[model samples]
Target: MKKEKGLQKATDFSGIKTIDDLHQHLKTNPDDADELGEHFITKLNNAYAEKNKTESDYEDLLVALDEWEEKPEAASKIRNTTYEANYLIIGACIHNHIVNNICFPGVTAIQRETGLSRTTIYRHLKLDDFRPYDKLIRGKHELMAKRALEHLYYIGVVDRNAGALKTFIELTGFSKKSSASNINNYIQINNLKITREELDQLPKEITEQIAELISEGLQAKDCDKKMEDMTT
Candidate 1:
């Protein structure tokens, strides 16, 4: 594991895009999650030794690890990778599925559906499973999945995935042209203070221009002006 710490530090290269590049870099360094966990254990031992603190905390951590190893589910999860990294991959899978298939579900829904703890899901979305150390302390993963969806939305890959099931919040507003005839029908049906006789008394050209404007999404004022000029 100590060897892994060296590998982790040495392999961190910036500006690399795509997973293949990452795989190549990692292959050269060859560090795994076991090494990462062992490295953290060593650090914890050093800190406790320096402070001359009670070893009970370290002992408890050891016991926790032992228990986790015995648990079939946890053991399988951490088989070839670190607990954190595996958790991250799971979260990404969950996120992709939710966005692509089911409507964007909130954290509660995600938790209920995936049966993963909220903390783990948050950590995956926010800090990529707390790899770099500082991120673990920063509390950045709070609502991380939600933030990722928002990023996707701004990029136009996904629409509003919230508020109503099966209905995305429309940014373009109601279709004015599509509804104009319905609106006119409603106004006519209501018969508020005006009668068919009054509508009939209006000039035929004015009525025709109003109909055209309503159907074509043109402003009534512009339609009226155009009709008047045509007559002149």
Candidate 2:
């Protein structure tokens, strides 16, 4: 009796609370000890399997998150590019030009200054770098000079106090040109290592246009500074 009591105490310490609970647990309850033990073992195995699967799932999720963090630019293509994005870019460039006094002439002004037609001005706006300018011109039923002017204001091209649309088309002083070492640094940082073969694959006209723009931009460095000095 004392040995049974000690055994009972040990089982109780092991968390087998009651005899009925113990009987149920040990598969020695009344009639189906072996079958009941088998069921209980199966349940224990299932619980362990579920815990391992959960841990594996969590590890996979962490790895996926790490990969995403490592390559944000890869995720960028997941987003669709839209006309609105084009507008914002052009708007920013135009605004910068306006603020710096690199202005394009008006409808008649472009005609007088560049010897380009109003239709040409519209066409110029269609270019990727000038899309925002084009959107301003084409957004409404009316020929809204105000909308174009407002976009310029938003881009910080026109001074609020001056209340005038600065030209977004032209800047001066291009003869003394310098290479943009900064652009090379940028290309390297962005991993945009284009080969000569890739350049050749581009349409000849586009390649020429890109070359001209780069040459013009490098030539026009410090153009606004020269203009400011001339004014002073």
Candidate 3:
């Protein structure tokens, strides 16, 4: 009987031969940068698969990459033509934790690993830009805020009487004044439960005074009744 053939495994381009070869390949196949990025991601996943990489490792990488990218020598090496190479470097840097900036490497570490100067790495980072990745982070914070607000509403932590503006301020770390202004605008735009008039009626000073009094052990029921009478 004929011997059965084994399945062929994908070729690992991980062992790139030379810098020139890498430059040429990236120059020739610009679109392939995305594929190279995926390859780098796979490499990272495999590397961290067995042992969990610490937060410091990821942070160090970001700092290293940040420093490396600013070098003039780095820019001149990849200058103008190799989008694939640029994308590959960035993809590797931000692979698993795109939303987490801590995953980025510092310049010295990146240089040590890639054998490239800081400038070259810097150029690569700026090539396609990481703004889209940054947006992912901002989007995450926004989602969290939304969920927190939903929870507050569900558990009666916030209600028509106790507006979500305070919770939004606490969760978002925005100042009470700014948070109120922003929440007012948001409520107006979305036509949410709170109205502009209601928000305007309770000035920041009065709300703060009420909060202070409540914190001082004043009866909340009496305070609420007083606030209602004052507003009316």
What does candidate 2's lDDT look like per residue over 1-232, in tens digits?
4554344321122343233444454443333333433443443344334432222222222233323345443222211122333334345545665677778434454334333334334444656644433343365524465566556544433222211212221111111231343232211216566543454466856644654554455446657778889999
Q: What TM-score does candidate 3 reach?
A: 0.31
State the displacement of the C-alpha of residue 126, model 3, in Å, after optimal TM-score superposition.
17
* Top candidate by TM-score: 3
TM-score, every prediction: 0.21, 0.17, 0.31
lDDT tens per residue, model 3, 1-232: 9999999676456554344444566665655554554554454344334323222232233233323435544333222223344345546755634455555666666655554445555655574553333433455678987787767644433233334434543454333344554633323235445444554577887655544443333346657888999999
Q: RMSD per prediction, one decimal?
A: 20.1, 28.5, 13.7
**Residue range 91-184, candidate 1, lDDT tens digits:** 5656786778785666665555554545545654575445543333234565664576456444332222232211111222222222333433
Question: Scored by Cα lDDT, where does model 3 land?
Answer: 0.47
Best by lDDT: 3
Each candidate's lDDT (Cα)?
0.44, 0.39, 0.47
The candidates, ranked best first by TM-score, are: 3, 1, 2
Q: Which stretches of candidate 3 lie over 4 Å from their true place?
A: 1-14, 17-21, 27-41, 51-134, 153-176, 179-232
